[model samples]
Target: MTFNAVTFTVFLVLIAVVTVMGFVASRWRRAKQADRLDEWALGGRTFGPFVTWFLLGGDLYSAYTLIAVPAAIFSMGAFGFYAVPNAIVLYALGFLFLPKLVSLAHKKGYVTLTDFVNDRFGSKALSLAITITGLLATLPYLALQLVGLEVVFGALGIGGSGSWFVRDLPLLIAFGVLAAYTYSAGLRAPALIAFVKDGLTYLVVIAAVIWVPIKLGGFGEIFRKGGAALAGKTTSTLDPAIAVNPSVYLTLALGSGMAFFLYPHAITGVFASRGAKTVRRNMSVLPIYTVLLGFVALLGMMALAMGVKPHDGNPQYAVPQLLSAVFPPWLTGVAYAAIAMSALVPAAIMAIAAGNLVSRNLYRQYRTKPVSAKSETLVSKVVSVLVKVGALVFVLTLDAKFALNFQLLGGIWILQTLPTVLFGLFTKRFADRRALLAGLLVSVVYGTWAAYQVKSATGGPFGGSTAKPFFLDSPIYIAISALALNFAVVVLGSVLARALGAHPRAAGVAEEPVAASN
Candidate 1:
């Protein structure tokens, strides 16, 4: 795994170019009074169909999608490929609700999901809970991106076999560049860089899907060998199996699809769009990346066919190592660059979203006096830098395997907000603020306890994310089960409150007046 100078050189050049572009992006749209939170955090809601497409696509098909999805396939076989259907259903779900969200956000000047929750229920407490949950969920997700970057560095032979700092020096440097540009350009940085990330990703993936199969004889031969290898394994857990557990598969796909747009980063991307038309167009078009993901997932099968094993216990390295092993140093460099940029673009957006969550929801709530728009944007920029740094620290200290579990756990936490944010959008009955809080607390507690009971290969409770509750036949995704519980609590609690004649304090101010657009 010695570093190839050719590959390393190419990687550095691409990194340098992208870093410069990220900084330059601050001026790309050139919004007047860029100091406002809307301008800085949402790109002034000016992005049209083309830029919105790339931005949201880039946000969704992250390094986690490129690296971790393949890694999951490599390690977990048919179950890991659940990401394919999950992505398709995710867009289908998005098509139904995201445009409405975009319209509401534009009409109300809402920059974060918490703002919507606050306005809908007129409860600062509910808004604060939503804000805290978003920040907590987003941090680990941001760390997962850093883990993706770390995998790239490890694949390049820039790390490992060294002191801790030496191994992590490259990551720190990469994150420093990310933080700087993100602070300067905000959402625009990732929005512009998404073009380059998506282009490189498509080129590398298309080449691998085509070239790797021919090199290995054919798709038929590759699968035959892959199946043989899996069949020889003694353990059911680690061994590759073509059959997916129907219960697990369906829950994961449906639960994750529902939670996709609920993510702050996804909402941030949507809010940046120019209109509902832009949101709808992007939703229709984003599935092309899912097709690309299908091809990328095959890289895991290719690795299996070649009998390539990851150096570490982490399966996340499977795709990166496969690319380095199969492609020339130069093309591998380009591929690594693509994967690295995939990490950067999403990390930047997640940080920005986290920052916005804090500034708009937390910071403003606590302030004694009104915070000017300029002041809010400044605080968000500072907080954005801090968020990236925190993620860098998190990835540096935690096990890479835990990073994946953390992301899954994050899905559980974020999904709890759906009862309030998603359902509250269309109905006032579900707008009971206290019920929202009660549902959120119960779901999180149950999900965390369930996750804690599921032991990991790493030999720790809470180390794995999926668990079955109430002794289901097949394991259910904890998030889905938790969400069901949340909905029940919301409904039952809303009923009891009304039965007692306890009017929600928020009910008086719940509905935002909608003006007719000419």
Candidate 2:
């Protein structure tokens, strides 16, 4: 791959522009109480529908969605189409559930889902479970974003050569700039950057849809050529052959939809909305991005049609290579910058969400005395930086290919919170908080162990998220199986606890705000 100096310069200028914009965003809305948790972490929860739309879209569709979705299609064919349907299903579920959750969080002054858990259940044990699971799940998700950034860096020919630190220097510097603004401006940084991130995304996707097919002689030729190359590959493109296990595909799609909003960062987006109606309105139109994702996935087929061979046989490079083949150097740089910035929006959200979880859920608990609002915000800022650093280290150490499963694996851990997050939304007393806590514990361990036992086509453990438990004839999504076990424990364990007279930590959910006084 040849490096273009103009393209690199354009990309650098874009990054610098966004970095300055991120810093300026702390003053965008110019709140009176800037250091308070609500202002810093939730952007004062005043974002209107227009801003909320971009923010949610930016946070939801990360670089992983842009990079890995197409990469999977390039390598795995029809199976990777899961990213599209699952996104559609996710919005439908979110439209139904998110307004209510956001309302509860907003009404109760909850910064993190763990705050809601503490208020609703009155149990630190349950809150701890939610917070730990969220952080653990989020780290890999953050790592996947870095993986996306690295992919763009490599495509742009700036994946520097030499030792480990030297090679990732570009990525590290970008992340460093991201961290500085995020720390200074908090959620507002990403909120402001989202407009740029999403605008470029639409332009790049639309351009690729028109330009790639035109370069390859149109969609008809693309399909004809791509289909021929993908022919007789049962798991190939256009075959609709997901895998040998039909049930597995259905379960995987359904589970992916269900687990999408349970991630803490997702809930953070909901919490950041102006009101429940803002969320409802955004979900109504959020599928615009979903449609965009569909076209982006087709870039894989265009790659095949153009005969754009990947670097080092790694198909993750297919889309980047495709861009270089079809588009001018400047446009390719724009496309790469769009993809790279996609990581920043979601990565920032994830870190801020984790920072909230730790500062409020974890750090607040251990304090011998009450924590000050300024201290809380400071701690959150520090934690956000550490989270990014941890993700940077993770992507640097592990095989980038492993990141394809990061979202799935993260789902396995995050899905255990469903009984608490999704269920707690409707009713307060579905089961004992203790039973729910126990259920979470059981599901996280079981789901991970189950997923770990399943071997990939390459014969390694943690190969995938689909597993065949003894109760099923075919492999099903491990998250679904683990969720079933969670509900079972909640039901039976609650009954047993009731029989033994072990009561809940609180009888009814608290009405007062859970956040500490400012």
The best candidate by TM-score is 1
Q: Candidate 2 clashing pairs?
A: none
| Candidate 2: tens digits of C-alpha lDDT, residues 1-518 | 67899888878889888889999998899799888987898999999999999998899888888877787767766667777878888889888777877787777788988887787778877888888899888888988899888888888887658887888899889889889999999888999999999999999999999887767788999888887766634442212432636777678878888887888888888788898788888889998888898998898888878777788876878998998888888988898889888999999999999999899888887788999999999999999999999888878887864655665678998988988765566654447777889899999889988867764343654767777777988778899999999999988877787787764444324443322111
lDDT, each prediction: 0.84, 0.82
TM-score of 1: 0.95
- Cα lDDT tens digits, model 1, 86-204, are 99988998888778877888988999998888777878777888888888888889998888888888888887767988888999899889999999999999999999998999999
Inter-residue clash pairs, candidate 1: none
Which stretches in model 2 have alpha-carbon errors above 4 Å?
Answer: 232-244, 402-407, 456-458, 499-518
lDDT of the structure predicted as candidate 1: 0.84
Our model 2 lands, by Cα RMSD against the true structure, at 3.2
Query: Candidate 1's error at 429, in angstroms?
Result: 3.7
TM of each candidate vs. truth: 0.95, 0.94
